[model samples]
Target: MFQNLSERLEGALKVIKGKHKITEINVAEAVKDVRKALVEADVNYKIAKEITERIKEKALGQKILIAVEPYQLMIKIVEDELAQLMGGQKADLMLTGSPAVVLMAGLQGSGKTTFSAKLANQIKRQGRQVLLVACDVYRPAAIEQLKTLALQIGVDVYSEPENNNPVAIAQNAIQYAKANHKNVVIVDTAGRLAVDEEMMNEIEKIKKAINPCEILFVVDSMTGQDAVNTAKAFNERLDFTGVVLTKLDGDTRGGAALSIRAVVEKPIKFIGTSEKIDGIDVFHPDRMARRILNMGDVVGLVEKAQQAFDEKEAERLNKKLRQNQFDFNDFLSQIQQIKKMGNIKDLMSMVPGMSKMMKDVDIPEDAFKSTEAIIFSMTPKERENPQLLISGNGSGSRRKRIALGSGTSIQEVNALVKQFEEMRKVIKKINAMQNTGKKLGKIFGR
Candidate 1:
């Protein structure tokens, strides 16, 4: 997402590379480049200058370690400052009261409605009964849109289609939650094209009426500095508890994420990483800073994996692998689990050093479509027994049928069968080695 900024920052750090000491001349040169990078990434000029000045001071005043290179020290300093510029740590939502109320606010087209559903889905996954309150009475079909999303996420939505008062809708929704035993009520309020008194007043009244435990101001990160300014206005009026940056997966310069907390004095609670309902992630400043500097977020990647992979299913797959029973059905299930982890490119970028390596690589979202299609075309027997599709007397006809069903060439089917056979062999070898290891451990007792 911050590819250009990351590349520029890397180039900037190279200014002091190979230098034994952090000299003022080299530090100034590096700091200048860093400032330029930040500015080019749509960060405010004054904020960029201030942060770069701190970096410069830290570089000059620090005592260099024997093992740490000058470039490495500078990277650490920049990463720390960037994290500080954003929130120093992750901010969590306060879900208090019998039914905690969360008020959503933002300008029109800021993804306020969509993020409401995403948040509800996340809270529902956390074992809470969530009620999505659609208070956008002015916009046509806004309530219906929320209803559709709520249905997709399997959450209840409260809306008064005929009622124009958002404050009343919110108040009634809270009552509904109490009566229905819902523990969380997320009120999605309306937004205008620009910040205005009417929109501000309505949201403020709703906030007062509902007394939300958290007021999240959602903004489009692609809006750059404008998102920061809009957040400032909302914070001044409604005094939001936190910020939510949406559309972060777009071709954004990342200025809003870096500047909003410094400007509005609020923590960024969550970021919308993709369009999927499960695309939301708790904003972690240190991880994001590392990512911006091209040092990938291993912790975040692991968290994604933990969320996507089901424990019971994982145990099942492990048993299959250990028994050398890994088949196409199991392989397809694994692919689906990985797809649930969000965008392929985004997931890969989380690996250490992969972001820089994939800077120019275009990994499409549907990169696995062909593989999935080919697998789906196989019969249950064929999927369970890989040998059924291999090159043989009867296997040729089976492969041809699969190729026709999957809309792929015969050569593609043959290649997939060959790859699957190789994979099965590898699994068998691994299982054999594991068995041998266990036997040796039992035999060589002290």
Candidate 2:
């Protein structure tokens, strides 16, 4: 997710490594690099320049505030500027009407169908009864896709295969929702390959017929600047209440996310990360800014963790983490918690600095298999405290036996032991920093 742009920005900022103060020269050099990073990431050059100019002004206006360095101040300034660029505040969907009608609009392959399902699931998580309406008449396959997702997620979908008329279908679906006590109706419509008059009229008719509470323009963030243009075209016809930026889980350059809000003057209500029903997230500006700056988004991470965290298990892990007694067993346990939360790479990016380190590295989705096997082979004592496996004691011999039992070499066993040791050290450092600092520490424990 904007990995390349992140690295480029990091490099750009490094140009003033030894500088004691912010100079027009250093700041300009850095801003140029920032603009280049945005452009390369598929941002419109004009929007890119506008953002960099604002970031530059904010950087130059930074007050030292007693002890902060220029570069550090600059990072803070840039984070804020970037946040403002991507919608200064989180915009929520207005699902106010009873049987609230939420209409989706976009170009074909822009993920309108998937996003509709995802949105339904998200609303269901809010404890609302949701009805997913497949109004995409052109593709019978689109109705199948939405139905499959709805069935997989345990949500209800309303479709009129025989009707072919989207506006009438949506009207009947709303009637069905009212009859069935469904609180929200998400109407997914057909999309053209490009913006066309026919597409606009169809969506507009649906809007008029349903008198929807909200109309969202779903655009593929992978298209970068074109995403902004697509949003504009949709907004002109639909007067969409919000925007849905999909495919951010891909290698998007961060351009669309940065420029869409500013250009369309519409709130970006949600983002779609994956095909999974749970892959959708409500847009939050501060959390996203924190993510972009490589500062871990503890708020977002905790929410995810809470959804999957078992109270008893989490408490047990918390005890070990606090005592600095986290070991290979604990590491494996944490990995399991992460895996249950869904995609490993997607969850990993929720942690700030981890993704940068993983950029060039390949983490096989099954990368943890060997670790799991080794842990399964370990005796209770060795799992509890890795010290038993550290030296040539009888326990060491037993661990060697376990390694062979697990069909892994001694080197693999040693690597696992070493990795656990390093993990404990890092966790201890983080715990100390959090406790010592107070605020950011509670985040880690959570």
**Which candidate number would show the highest lDDT if scored against the true structure?**
1
Q: Mind sharing the TM-score for model 1?
A: 0.97
TM-score of each: 0.97, 0.81
Cα lDDT tens digits, model 1, 100-214, are 9998989888999999999999999999999999999988889999999999999999988888898999999999999999999999988864457777777778888989999
* Model 2 poorest ten-residue lDDT run: 192-201
Over all chains combined, what TM-score does candidate 2 have?
A: 0.81
lDDT for model 2, please: 0.83
User: Could you give candidate 2's per-residue lDDT for residues 1-446 as a string of tens digits?
Assistant: 77777777778878666678888899999989888977887777888898899988887777666577777877787788778888889987888898898988888899998888888877888899999998989975888999998997799889888888888999999999999999999998998744477777777888999999999988999888888887887788778899888999887887888888888899888998776777888898777877776765778888888887789998898988888887767777787887767677767777878868767777566777888899989888778778787764785687679789899988898888887777778988988887787766677878
Question: After superposing candidate 1, which stretches have Cα over 4 Å from the reference?
Answer: 193-195
Residue 247 CA displacement from its true place in model 1, Å:
0.3
lDDT values, one for every candidate: 0.91, 0.83
